[model samples]
Target: MDTTFPRLLLQHASQRSSAPAMREKEYGIWQTLAWGELRSLVERIACGLHLAGLGRGEHMVVIGANRPRLYATMLAAQALGAIPIPLYQDAVAAECVLPIVNADVRFAFAEDQEQVDKLLEIRPQCPQLSAIYFDDARGLRNYDETGLHALDALIERGADFAKANPAWFEAEVGKARPDDVAAMFYTSGTTGQAKGVVHTHRSLLDRAKAGADFDALTGDEEVLAYLPPAWIGQNIFSYAQWLACGYVVNCPESAATVTIDLKEIGPTYYFAPPRVFEGLLTNVMIRMEDASAPKRKLFHAFMEVARRVGPALRDGKPTGMLDRIKYALGDWLVYGPLRNNLGLSRVRVAYTAGEAIGPDLFTFYRAIGVNLKQLYGSTETAVFVCMQPDHQVRPDTVGVPCNGVEIRVAGNGEVLVRSAGLLKEYYKNPEATAEVKTADGWYHTGDAGFLDAQGHLKIIDRAKDVGQLADGSLFAPKYIENKLKFFPHIKEAVAVGDRREKVCVMLNIDFEAVGNWAEKRNLPYAGYTDLAQKPEVYQLIRECVEKVNADLAADEKLAGSQIHRFLILHKELDADDGELTRTNKVRRGFIADKYGVLVDALYAGRTEQFIETVVKFEDGRSGRVSATLKIDDARTFAPMKAAA
Candidate 1:
């Protein structure tokens, strides 16, 4: 079988010409595109690129939300042996400049005027960028056309070129090899500048196929392509796996409409980072709080039953007949309606990756029969190194190694992987590539984890972020932080105690959750900073911290890592503020460095710390927010007594 994406796409087109290949929600209507239509569109675009002098070995950048045309543009570029580098569409011009300049991008496809403007703004920094094409022409009618062209125009040009040179398009596609670099993805660069990871067709296809087979995914399964295509995880799930398994992909109308579109589509296979799931659960809990007393009572009653037997039943574990009957009744009364509301009723297989999910949150989904599981991988591994099989899912462990993937722990406890999906190299950055990929074909995952007795991989934290207490007790900030974030009010947290006596944390409260809580109590405040400093808010968060400490105390190994001192951050952590990556993963080092004073206050026993932080707004404006943040101490629990 052909491994290159172009050939695989052609094969699907011939085999399932009339079947739905992709769908896009446009103007309140779902528009379907058939496999045959996709093939013709890709061919025209590929031909157009060829006519426009886009040659083999050249690089093209795709910047936009998930759209059918944007995806096709990637395949078109690949058909001509050109590499497509998808950048996060919401990224500022400055953030986008580095990869564009480093990759020496020659052609770029933008979604609309906003993306086109960003590319134009950064064009001087990327001299190699010759042509900029846009999909939506709205707001672009009066723009400079020096090198700007509409994607539709490009397709028309390609059609004309194909008539003139009929064999040229297929000839270019025929030249693709399994070993050829299929795509280039830039890392999120949580710690430093982003590096482009290059993967061959063989690497991506092999991993995608393995995952598809493991999940028993079929061509009929549907998925929502809402994540940033720039992220390798999204590419692996929405592109590589979609093509490999011939599944249908749906694009939400907009970011704001994802929830509605999700319900309308009811995707069979879904993937989200922990934060997404957290947000969904938070919303559910918030709504439940406002529900009528009778409804709320019914919900709690059924939830109790689900919590007891839902996971057992989900894993096919033996359960009492009475409990099974109770669970079935509860599923009808609570779980079924709840799943339908969250648009997860059809989810046969779902996954969460990118960061550690809170164990309670992980179990809650399973208990509700969502089939939620965890997987662990990075961009360097083409996004599949380990995956939890159904009935083998655990909240703590990510899963066993994927098919044909070998995982081992280094002496220092860093997880290393050797897999068919391992990236070939970091494009134009051999030094960076060499640092992670060894001569023996092992790719250093830079994650600290160990295999459990059951052979499941348990990720503690990033190798660099895992620290030790002053007395040499293990201090995993993410572990504690995840525990804190489990509380709906605590949206983001940073635990700091490396080489210190005890753990301290700085957290940002969920504005929506806390604000609503405050309003219900007649506690009026101005904004996030104002509301955060409120006495009632602090008390509320203190309870959350104390609860986390109690949970930590129950575990002998992590009892000493409980939070000792904490403070509510003056502002919410934002990607625009450089505290989070585009995908919402914390920039730990950056946050620590940026808020060093706050960290010092937590450790120094200061009652309050005055701080003024410079922040960036969505409109590219900069401003300062100053506040006196109060430090609070939480009551830690003593270790639980052993069984007697």
Candidate 2:
């Protein structure tokens, strides 16, 4: 009858005692822990926290990269019936204050001295915050000892406590209920303050079970835990799924070193946002371009064979014996190594969520034999609403609702869902919660979508952002932006002019692709800001726009979204600048306000303009950058062909 997360650890430990639980790279070495060892670590940490006066319902914050200790602390909190709140290690001192205050976190297990200092800096402001425990003791020689405690020292103290009072830990865990709160996640608000989403143990477990039912993951599969633990996606993938399906979670050494760690793990289960996948594809293409001539020729030849047979196989089309044999040879000779190089050789069930994945990026992985599928969910829904099932996967749809989940579209095309995994409420924000949750208990997803005959959900865009042009045709920016992102030269795109003369857009060039083009032409640049403003870069973007226009013209469902005008911004949008969220979602309102002058220049009927913008550096310094802006008429394409 244990309701805490520690039971997940003990459950797997007993069932798969010898199975590898976590592997982290440190100082050019890979460190591993079997399931039994991982469970023991959690028990010791739990006993340590208990001896330090932490008890049931207390809050403990974990701040660090993906590591065994960080994960151990999470389970330790659950072992004592305490809630574990995860904070993004990269968040600045000011950004950390709100969540710390909201959770009323007094005890914290920080990865390094830097994070411990961040908490200490705001200790005066946060009345509930007191004790700070650090895993790495580097640079802490001068820190005060009143509240600072080294993890090693605490573990020594806990060993004595476990010998004296072993039953107390079990008693506290027994008090926890399935509906009792397990964690509080803070999601950045588009309008103002961050709201804490409270999730219960039942919510997490049900969500994980739904996900397992959706994809039918096996126990032998492995997952790479590289994304920020502050994200719900990471919580579900790294913790909940491990509990539900007994899959192993691989921890990367650090964010910068994920690629190398991924190669070593060769995980069977993978999940990433569209940007991450796009970057991976871009990097692979760049490396191939620099490969020897013979390797390049052989790679392309096999890819050609893959291009022909892979799609047919994916679609279950009939093929002759010779074509099947040729495909097998191509896979063994070319696609096999390509997958190995990208750390996807063992990928069985991969998923892309958080944003629409370009069809090209989607197909590339499938062409190489990875079952890359799309999923649809939000933080409020516990990240398990719909997922494309194996072999029934479609590029446009985000598969059927998961087990025990129900979804329906309102008359206005807004999606509504009801599931056991739904959040109880926005913590202390009943008014806001009441708005999103209906009296009948359906959670308004705020996304506009339709269900196909196959019962798959086809999301068009946000419900509010689905506007109409003067001709009354739908203008879905995300739909068009996904089309633009499919092009190699285009990286990020924003479509504007919803109710105006025509659909205009802004494009961010793929820096690596455009920078390489500049280098080959002997065009030198100081940085991204300078390179992006080059006149030749405008010509390059123009070609990309033309290509996207041609692709759109062929698709009748999206012909009205063709670009009519566009201008490249001098500076890239950064999350720290408030233009993007911590989750990497564009803050459309903030961007529109910050770049209002640039937007004006694009539609002012002028070919050229100048803009001066205030920029903020990571070190809390501010400056200004003024550059001449170039505006080009967005490429126009032929109208949709008459209905057959």
Candidate 3:
């Protein structure tokens, strides 16, 4: 019953020696590595790291995509009693400097030449960083630099060291304890600077085991590890759970090839944020537009039937014979092919977190036979606070509290949790840690939610993000934004109305979806900027806003929060532009400050606003984009009176 990650890895390797433990897509084919092989590889890496001056209790940074080698490196660090800090691969060098410097990372591993170059460039700023290793040696053949070594060479060194000192590796692994910190993860910092959240072996393993048991997962289950390992949710699913349940973990070749790789693997368990699902649905809708008239008709007809009975069939609810037959036909004609195309045909249990998913989007997956549910958690809680049970799933709720977890709402409406999976501390920041974690051990979740009559948790929004209107009405921006994002045409929305007279929003259109819609009408446009500025596009978005307003009018609590003014953003919100965090959470304060002029124009009732924004490219180049965005007003509905 050892719960430490290294102990679990050793146990699984001995019990399932020849079973497939990990797979990586390489050169267009899957390369499998067995459990025994994984054990030997991790042992060599641990020995090599020790031989190369990595000491117990020291820190090592892993910056890479979801690669088998990167995952092993994490375990290898743990095997030697060293801690691994995984960073987002997409973060720029400047964005990476803080964590590298703060963690005092001396040894580092990068995915390829691009990541190695970034580490090398930032090395001067991080004098503590002594060694930089890379897995892919494609472009490092010519460069000669100190403290730069290939991972293959390190593993070779490790193998030689292991032969010379066999007992050293085992002794180090034996030294690991349940209370020892297993890993360090940096928060996404949507509100402020990222803080390192540290968790112990016992805390993380307990949550992972609870989650696996809740879903009845087995060693035969398969999962795709494509999300950033730096995030707590990804590490919980891909690392802790993989070792806890002895499941096979598959790593996609690259970010660009995830969709194709997912199809090839056909994973049984899946987890994605709401945005990924939205993008998948958007692509499907765009393609359906170009299909033949008969094909389009067939899709729509089956979809209507699916909407009627898909959820009922999925939940094993009773239905009439005629409805059941219609659903069967729809499943054969639409649901089956659609699930296959989206690579979710084999998804036995899927969950989405990090934000509130649109109800329409959530229902679509369940209606199409994808068993997609929602969970609610944060980095400080080890990513499992609330999870939906299969038969008890509901679109508006994130289900009951997870096993071994306790949840209660504070007087201010912020959710509070006390669980074995709670974080140990915010590394080196006692002041920040004290603000959230109380003396009584309840971790303040900072999310506003309430338990329903059925003991299900329903998240309203971030407690800090909820505001009040000038007329003293409740205003929740995320509630309104989720409504806007439910529309296929609107990819991103930011609502603003704290202490303002009425709610207004900034919009970003889905380039592919709206572009396809425009082309069908023979409306020519040059690019995103041109299409976004087109008068027809404004009219289209106006209709969407009006529809949301009508829906809001029907609800007494949020009727006053309806959108009154809106403008299409001059450009899409980009992580590089500081509009979004690395994990894709909007930086509300940063966006508001950067676009203050636009917000001013919206409230002032100006017809148009001129803005010039500086943007950064992938290659670190900077440029400016200027536009004259027109402001549009939508018709608002009067609130309905409740029966007395």
Candidate 4:
């Protein structure tokens, strides 16, 4: 199409001028913007930024929730031939400093007062940050800060600039080329400092169109933008794909209102990480646990049938008449209402990525008729490497290589990919770029897995994390941890058994789910710490661990990876505490280093271990959390046929 994002906007406005382009919820109401209106908005912002000294090739940072104004601001930056860098809005100010300094960002568009405060707090460290424009004007009216302006004011300035020079907008936008740098997304920095993943317009748009075509997405598809725009997956699904397919993108009012907004929008094309899906299912199950006996009984009876026959029906497979009748009845009585309740009733093609989803969780959606599938990709790949085709979704494998993507596995089991969608380079870090991208165009994915006989890609774990046990059998922590997380009561788990005699785990129980279970049994506790140490809770967690072990025993290769001992931590694994990445992926090595004492206790077969650790409070205060956490043993099943 030879299109930049701004050019695509112009085309849409020219072709489908009156069609809905974007919608946002505010004060409990949704306001829609048409394609023509969006084009005008982008032009005005572009001219305004141009007037504000934003020149071609300069970097502008975009940080905040998925607001329409923010999207326009990003396109506006690109319209001026400036590259837009998106940062995680939930990140601490210290984390933001590195990227801003690395990019030498001069102007930024923050969503609201909270985001503005973060930018201001780091202004001293980022002296080059000359201008700041905010979308929401809630708490900034009284502050007298230099170079701080409202987004409305920017638009007004843009309008005046446009009137004065009508040709300037088109001329600036015409300078943008398909191969120009479009956006920069930072890695999660699991091992070290985050790196800026640079992607050109050609790479992102090509993959966007490929995905949209594979799913047959069109303007009629509705998408809810809830995840942080900083993540490449969210950017691809909500931004690139929206422009590629000319779909209607909906922005939630706030994180708190995503569920309500999701239901109201009833998005047809949706994407979420595994954590979101797991949380939703946990909440639904918690509610079901509290339902009256008769209601629960009826729900379970129908759900059992859905679990058996729903996926077969969804995949257009053959089924006996009696089974079909039972499934139809179940859909009417249980599955239909459940899908509607989860805001997935209208979902035609939904995707989960970023991490492996549990089988039970994946099947639940498909079993209830939501075509939820898994995809495999990362920021460097423009987020589209593999996708499960229609009627071929499986929880075990991610999928076959998608259009324009070639995948191969190294002798060490690391997956490698070559695609037009691969990242151009890491900004200012050529050495690091050379490490991942080769001369022949293959990008080392660092994920360990191989293609099965059916050509499906099965991801085991990170190549660095995949290890062998003391007995020379293989061990994959993610494989075992995901099995534990499949149980709604277990929210997060980390397995440690690399080159060890046996595997042990530390986990965080889902507070809400456990609390509900406790309340139902008339058990009382004060808070997370008090509840987590309960003997009954430990027993509950141990049973979940044993179930996973039993499942592992059925697989010959993974049978040796069964968890032998486990403990429920006195605290949740949190990003603020540095136990997890911003995307909530566990930083396994960091956690191991931080809690070396606990890992030692688990291996030593201690029944209880007392430890006090420093924790960062939400308000930036530091305090100590002390607990004598109890460790418990779990039963490991013998494999049906053990590995040689």
Candidate 5:
């Protein structure tokens, strides 16, 4: 058995010398990298870092979107026994800069000039940062510095060094150990400031190999590397899995062109957050509405059949010959083209993580034979905990504990996990480490959930967020919010009242769907902010909310979470307003502070009100907008009848 991941990489490279190891979209073309070439590239990069006045135990930070070079650099850092810290690219300068400074990163690999500029702006403040390297040199044509180096130039220099002193670099690579720090990732601090989660080579390698083993990966598997590299989910999928499986890792030409790149690559293995899947589903549904009448009818007809049989197929049940024929027709006429259009034609295995996936959303893909499975983990675990195995998958639960992972539910229902993949500690934050990891050894997941009869983990909500109604009924805000969002009309929702009178909600309507409906009715609106406040759109959303209420009332465990009242805010809840985090996650405390008056009005039985709020344009300009707010009465349904 291999003890170190680097050894496995070398072993695989030697075994599969000519196999395609990586595929990246460059200059509108798909580029293939063989195993030998990839291994060589990593080795050379590692050598370059060794030569750049860096040695064992140093720390390096990588910032930006996903790219092949980013993964190479991470491995290169590990190979040199240095720690690489990947920061979320979507994070604002202030949100991410502190971690880089705190980690004392001396050499940094920046994705582009924008990231380079951010580092430069803070260089004076960070005395430890000695050099900044940029992979993409698009806009930094004139920027000159004693410490800045372009990626290509570094690679060339590394090549020349390797030719001159081959044995010297080998000695450095030999210095790496299983317990050496490999990387440090900062968690998206939705509740507090981001803390660096530290991982060692053993922790990461164990999770990577377990993931590869679970998925039964082969070198032929192709994956699209597009999510933010700072996220552990993407890091595990793109870098760890790529290195473990020796598969072809494909990068999108750029973030903007991911869709085009996906269509071109048509990867065999795919992973996305529930939000990405939701966007794809919404895009298909929207296009269907605009398609020809025959096309629309045919699409719906086949979907109806798929809706019936997809679950059966996903559950591995026996469908009769007639249903099988219908499924075949649906796949050929409806599902095939639909999957192709969504760039999922060749997908063999798919995973969704970072949040809970709605059952309907999970079923829809599985019904179409997508093989999508849900997994459970966090940055602390190197992103491996419980994963639903193929053919035994369930949407409501994240499946059995992964290999080498031990999971147990604490008395209060918080999920506790212990595994080789657990992070070493939070960098410079011993207090946080002590708070999360108990003296007994279990790492508290903070999520409230339990294992089902089948030994699968079913998450309810955050342990801190799970509250009770005045009537002593359970109210899971996240579950209710997810149900509301399932409707195409509502984009996002915030369920209020932790211990107040009744549950009320603030909704952000889907602009595209609402805008299209408004256009059909000849209702003119300026933009998203304008469209959100439209009275006509308000009535439409009211109906959707009522339907959600009816559905919630039917569920005994969640009836108390039904929205008692709701309001369409004068403006959409935006990240720029401090109402949402950079990753689009709602900052509940921040939002409540910013919109205290508005939330108060919803519960106070106000029919309507006018408010002025500041809005930030995408260009970083600030402006004010005023609009009329509309409120709707709480929806109430008749009490459920007792079973006879």
Candidate 6:
């Protein structure tokens, strides 16, 4: 298994040719492919790529959702010693221009008509782009543009080439080296323009096997390839590890049908970010609101019992006889069915990362007997620098360094890592590569964190976002924001306190979600402002704040950043109002100036303040609305004493 991807494919074909290599759900039926069939398909595609003038070290672009053929396209490019660069399927056409032009991409594989249209739209900007192949042919019967071909046409051409030159595919595959570039992943461009992180075969396979060994993953493990393949995390889980462990990676029918497909597949290995988990929890809670009164009562009653006993039982801790008996009954009556409904009944190991997960969300899954845990990594580190082990999961820390990874904290609190998984360099950006990777081989993680007494790595926030309070303790605004937003009542949050005495926040309540909550309780309101100012709604948000504070108290770095006072904004932060960017990301400085009085009120310890916001309608109309906002004090907890 310590080899290149093409070699791995050939090895598996020779060893387990009859074993299932992958699955694709189409037309509501699951289609399976054995290792031998996958190898044959890869060969034909590779031959096609070879005849298309895709030489060694050339770059090809793949875009769209996690379809089986798209995955095959990536493999085919690699099989011909060409690098595959996947662009986010949801990104607009203009956004696709930079990557295609930067990579000097000449060939592209598109999943459907939509992706093909984007490439065509960007072709003038990226004039070097000469060839395009589309997987789905529907709605394209009349698109007779030059250099355009259906994927079946390429395969037909490839079959002819292979027959004429029988030794061509094997010779090309054998020429690939372990250190050859395998794939390139682009950064999210949050901090700056995106850069391509180049990863080699040796690096990708090494980290893949390390993770598989850590989790004891085997060919028997089933994975649902649901997230975008453009993300390094999804690529590692579905592509890299799939080959490493020979797991059965299943592609859902489509994005709209993922939930039904997830239930049908019942995957044993799952991975998602914190937001996906939050959405699932919200849906479950929203549906539960429609149950009969007695059913609701019974569900909550057992959930309380599950919250008490489930985690301890899962972690193999000692429990009282009565608690164990109650947990068993709850499992049979509530937890088991809920898991089946959520499609987690077969989940053996589930992971979350890419952002700080809320403690409440982390606990909910583990409390329901889902082995939900956290890991820490980024695109630059190949997405596996740290990972939590079974029975030792915690929300605050992102476990210890993974196998073959060495981690240390820099003088300014930036975490550093030395691992085989580190990207070789940023393609065509040597200066940027030098900025992160130093001469001593350590990759500056750009994250502020420290190792806890238990040897776990605790990351707070991006080093630039992390600051000290007036009292010289840490303030991580994002961490606090994530915790509050997990409650499902709070939609948007902005924490204020970098060098201040205490922390405060302005919140936007989820109107529909809170309205549903109010209606269930027979509470009446005139509108959003009227509903937000209700004392009962404030109490609900207050309890959520207190819970976040409790979690903060257990972490060494974030203990000082607990929410002290918070106010509900009368209006949502609107991009049209210029309070947020066009991407809907909060414009912090603009809001701070727009509501200067509110900020002063929070720090001045004022009980109330008047705030106003301009509103814009979809019909090109503008108006003004105003309301007096009330700020409430929330209780904070002292830091938990370290275990002796």
Against the reference, the lDDT scores of all candidates come to 0.92, 0.82, 0.92, 0.92, 0.82, 0.88
Scored by lDDT, model 1 comes in at: 0.92
Q: Across residues 568-602, which tens digit of lDDT does each residue of candidate 3 receive?
A: 99899999888999888888889989999999999
Compose the digit string of candidate 1's lDDT tens values, residues 1-644. Answer: 24699988888999999999999999999999999999889999999998899889888999999999999999999999999999999899889888888887889999999999899888888888899999999999988768999999999998888788877767778899999999998888898988899989999999999899889999989999999999988999999999999999999999999999999999999999998999999899889888899999999898888888988999999999999999999888899999999999999999999988988899899999999999988888988889999889889899999899998899999999999899999988889989999999999998999999999999988899898899888899888988899888999998899999999999999998888888779999999999999989999999999999999898877888989889998999999889999888899889999999998888889999999999998778899999999999999999886678
Candidate 5 lDDT, 1-644, residue by residue in tens: 13455555677778988887777777888778777777788788887887787667888988887776887787788777788888776655556568877887799999998888878877878878898889999999999877999978888888888889877555666777778777888877778787899988788878988988998988779899888888888888887777777787887888889988888889899999887898888778788877899999998888888889987887788899999999998899889988888889999889999777778888889888788998999999998899988778877898999999998898999999999899899999999999989887789999999988888989999998898887777878888888778777787888887777688888888888777778768999989878887778878887888887888777767776678788877677776667776566777777777778888888789987777888887545789988777878767675465467
lDDT of each residue in 59-105, candidate 2, tens digit only? 78889888888888888888788888888887766788888887778
| Residue 574 local lDDT, model 5 | 78
Clashing pairs in 3: none
Model 3 error, position 366 (Å): 0.4
TM value for model 3: 0.99
- Among residues 3 or more apart in sequence or in different chains, the pairs in candidate 4 whose N, CA or C atoms overlap within 3 Å are none
User: Which 10-residue span in candidate 1 carries the lowest summed lDDT?
Assistant: 1-10
Reference-based TM-score of each model = 0.98, 0.95, 0.99, 0.99, 0.96, 0.87
Error of 5 at 616 (Å): 4.4
For every candidate, C-alpha RMSD to the true structure in Å: 1.2, 2.1, 1.0, 1.3, 2.0, 4.3
* Model 2 stretches with alpha carbons more than 4 Å out: 1-3, 190-192, 292-294, 555-557
lDDT of 6: 0.88
List the candidate 5 regions with Cα displacement exceeding 4 Å: 1-5, 570-572, 615-621, 641-644
Task: Show model 1 residue runs off by greater than 4 Å.
Answer: 641-644
Which TM-score value belongs to model 6?
0.87
The digit string of per-residue lDDT tens for model 6 on 1-644 reads: 34788888888999999999899988989999999988888888888888889888999999988877888889889989899998888666777888899999999999999889888888889999999999999888999888988899888888888889888877888889989999998887655577899999989988999899999999999999988899988999999999988989999988888889889999999998876787788878887898989989988999999888888888888999999998899899989999998899999999999878887788889988999989998888888999998878888899989999999899999999999989999999999999999998999999999999999999877887788799998888877888888888887788889899999999988887888899989999999999999999999999988998999899877888889999998888875576653233456667778888999999999999997777875433789889999999999999987788
Weakest lDDT window of 10 consecutive positions for candidate 5: 1-10
106 Cα displacement, candidate 2 (Å): 1.7
TM-score of 4: 0.99
Instruction: Judging by lDDT, tell me the better candidate of 2 and 4.
Output: 4
Worst ten in a row by lDDT for model 4? 613-622
